[model samples]
Target: MLVLFVLAFGLFAILNPRVFLNPINLQNMMVASPEVGILAIAMALAMLTGGIDLSLVAIANLSAITVSTMFTAIASSDPATAESLGGFIALIGVLVGALAGAVNGFLIATVGITPILATLATMQIFNGIAIVWTGGKTLYGAPAVLSSVGQATVGGIPILFLEFLVVAVLIGVLISRTPFGRRTQLQGANPTAAMYSGIRSTSVLYGTYVTTGLLGGIAGLVFLSRNPTASADYGTSYVLLVIVIAVLGGTNPTGGFATITGVVLATLVLQVVQSGFTAIRLSAYEYAIAQGVILIAVMVFDQVRVRRRPRRAPSSQTETIALAEIPRA
Candidate 1:
């Protein structure tokens, strides 16, 4: 991933040095990356558990719509009160995302529905709710403070980009330092073994989806802050883009592996490619075609790497052998 990022950056720098290397263009990439970067993190989390959350973008839209509507309504009646409670309202928006996640968790963990199917149904349901709430129109305006913070900068770094970094670091720590993260990976790798080892697969799955939901919610808030508008159909293409980011970031689509660092690097790579495309005046369709090609190439490379790699004894077999070697207690 690092190599890919460096190569992409260098190539773009060579092709469009003036525009690609411009400070303004770089800042734009930083600002634009968070919405998709954060969502990519969420998607990576789901993939870590051998599941996918197709409703993530829907959850984000719903959360953003909820926030936008509340802010607009409150600000319309009592601007002072709305200003005072802007933070609270934003928190509520994030909670809305968590609630949506809980719904997905329930359907998958409690109801035993397939992850894809459950999330697909909920995606429509969530989007439908957003449309009904907004009458299929865009809800514009957010707290002045929120928008300011979203667009703020410090030492040439975008506040939104900083937030994305914080999120990525925190998630990286959670996966690397926490027992739940270990359990999640284990569950994805071998559900039966995780069960035998007393891991509550259902709870893990539920928590996984909820966490992803929460992340989605955060992404939604960021989206609303950056754009100051919400609609049921906003970021409709992000679903696939995030998946591509996750996969390119070294996340296993089938589960049991993910890397926050890889995801971050992949995000940068895509951002550079995108900004480069714009600099070179490539059409959106061409950019999309490039994305598809990148995804396919990465998948093929991963397949080859896995195939050429030596397989190790299954952990279960290794554990059994070790247990057999031990004396009776």
Candidate 2:
């Protein structure tokens, strides 16, 4: 996937060096990516546990909407009061996300609902709440600090991109090094075996969902910062896009395997394609079609790979030993 991303980028750069390789264009690509990229990582985490978070985008929008509403209300009466509490408002958004995630965890983990059905139901619920909160309108005029966070750069790197990078590293370490991550993999691979081994499956599931919610909330913050607006329907297309990116990044649909590195590379690849399409004046529908095709192709390839893998055969010595241990007729 990394090689594919590199090749695709090189091809684009070759085809239109004036735009594709232009510094401003490259920066724009990076800046536009963090929202979807962050959501993709969150999706990957859920998929690693043999579950899918269909409500992630909804959660993000809800979180952002909640915070933005408060900011707007305060700013209308006291702009200085709102400005002084920018960081606090952002934290509240994240907490709301966490609370939303906990709801999902309770439903799927504690209540024993199927993950897909549970998250699907929550997605609508969250989205509805957001729409109701804002009367289907957009909220803007946040603090200047948020605007700076959204647009500021250090050493030419967008702060949002830096946040994404930091999250990627943290999640990578969590999945690759932590006990909870190990248990998640084990549970996904074989829930019965993991339970029998004394792993707290409930804790693992709850933790995974909560972590996903946290990521979604953080992504919401960045999204709102970038646009300085919160809308109930913002990023509606991202739900499917993040899932596609997660699958393409080597997060198994059946669970038990995932790679943050693959997720990052795949995100870059898609972003490159998206940027190129934009440069050529492609419509949003075209982008959706491209994503749908990519998703189908990746799923088909995964099925083919699984089918082609050789099954383990018993060794001659093991077979003989088994035969010897059998009771005499």
Candidate 3:
């Protein structure tokens, strides 16, 4: 993120000169961070458990579509209905997200499947449901108040940023300060050891998946609120971004590691680069190349770190010296 920050401001100030660091652009960055940020946290936690949640982007898409669809349905009957039902709409979103997450947890834990395969199956499944719901229609008739949450702010900061902040802080505290969090790390680090030590590995694993699913649902709402429109194609391109944010932010895929703050920083980096791409007139497709490159680099570094920490092999040069110095035994 620091790199992207520097790259964004440096290049933009040099070229655009008048507006790169302006509050407007800064606000835009913050407003844009939530959807990815929310999903990034979920992805980070899931990856920290030695698993992945490919279904999140799909779930997010579903949530966004749900928000838009609900708003349209409610307001279509009586446009003023938003004033009355806005709170209920938000509540429904939370419930839907939580329920989806629980399903994810059950499939991974009790069903005994690899998370990658499990989530992959549901990724398509949930996405398919979103498509069927939308029937290939774009939802644009959102209630005005519901849409405001996306771009609204207080004291010069976007409310969406605050929403993301709340999630980050709440969950960060849960993971860093609580016993459940420690046990999660333990399970991720050494499942056999954690199990032998009487940790409920299945329950923890279930918790992890459900948490991912629930967060993904919330992420979906954020995406929908901000865009205030939905199509079947929602978040289809975001799966890689989700993984990139988590890994770049210092979450270990092999388990027992995560840094929520790092994930936030990583999201900033991506947004910065994305803003730069926008200013430089690069098509969105071009930025996909950038995302791909970063993913490969992050994955390589993570694998190297895991292997280096555990291998503990003597260097070839050190082994040669030991052989040479051996006594006549």
Candidate 4:
């Protein structure tokens, strides 16, 4: 229904004067999707694990700086510099992302730290490291080959979108088909019961964090390629958006469970909604307000549904008491 409204308005406005489906603007929307979408996937996974990643934007910015700087240094004209290092540096960045994910997992699972506090602290630390690494400098002159990931297309679809498809599928398998995923649901359902079942709940919890980190890293690289510039302030706006997508997709914050398709659908809705704000001349603050209102409304609705849902048949004791009162019959 909301999507219908946006489409109707866009169509009416286009008919009246403006052309809404400009190829260039849609392409711009596609380009922007990967950065936010990747973070949203990561955030969704973290939420499924009964946690959140407040440091996702930081992770993306930190990884972006690292990848861009390395690309700059390796692609330099000097002979002693690393040769053809675009692929190598990018690969290393990917692994480092997994490691960062593990760190998040360890903190929350083993160190008894809350996800919010741990991630918040790590967000500052990672962003600070990124700033210090460049000493407030921006990286330029990224290798042409590296930029192709953002600029290239296959069958008229953006490579970033393709990459996101691959990641999303991999995540879907992990959450939907794997034993770890089942155990993760159990953990979210009840930590004590999951532990008693020998599910090694800690491992599953750590895995969630590590996966979030890994996705954040990939998102950073994708962001760097699109902009082809490195800065300490990359991906900040995505933090709330990541959560928005997760919640809109129907992932429970109180428990770590979600579906890939739902998230994909939510992504489309958010993209359209955001585009609507732009089309409607909403200010940045107004857009933020709109997003907040949407999320709060949806969350409340879900809560109400949960409350009104009927549990299994009434307790056995009530049935026994009722039967005794009617024994004469």
User: Quick one: best lDDT, which candidate?
Assistant: 1
What are the Cα lDDT values of the candidates?
Answer: 0.93, 0.89, 0.81, 0.77
Clashing pairs in 2: none
lDDT of 3 by residue, 1-329 (tens): 45655765687667765555678888898998998999999998988778888888877777667777787787877878765787677667666776777777888888988889988998888878888988878778555665788768999999999999999998899799998898888888888999898999788987877777778778877776677787768767678887888888888878889999989888987887787677667898888898777677767876898888866689999999999999885
TM-score of each: 0.94, 0.92, 0.85, 0.86
Across 136-224, the per-residue lDDT of candidate 2 in tens digits comes to 99887666777898888989989888888999999999999999889999888888999999998889999999999999999889888
* Cα displacement (Å) at residue 140, model 1: 1.1
List where candidate 3 sits over 4 angstroms from the true fold.
1-8, 295-329
Model 4: per-residue Cα lDDT at residue 125: 85
- What order do candidates take by TM-score, descending? 1, 2, 4, 3
- Mark the regions of model 4 whose C-alpha exceeds 4 Å error after superposition: 1-18, 78-83, 304-329
For each predicted model, how many residue pairs clash, with residues at least 3 apart or on different chains? Answer: 0, 0, 0, 4
Please state the error at residue 31 of candidate 2 in Å. 0.8
Rank the models by lDDT, top first: 1, 2, 3, 4
lDDT of 4 by residue, 1-329 (tens): 24534664465457533434655656666777777888888888888867889998888777777777777676665524543667777777767677777878888989979898999988888888888888877776555555887898877678888888788899889888999888887787677888899988778888888888889888878877797787777667888888888888878887757877667666766666666567667677887786787778777887899999989897899999998899584
Q: How close is candidate 4 to the true structure, as a TM-score?
A: 0.86
Flag the better candidate by lDDT, 1 or 2: 1
Candidate 3: minimum summed lDDT over ten consecutive residues — where? 1-10
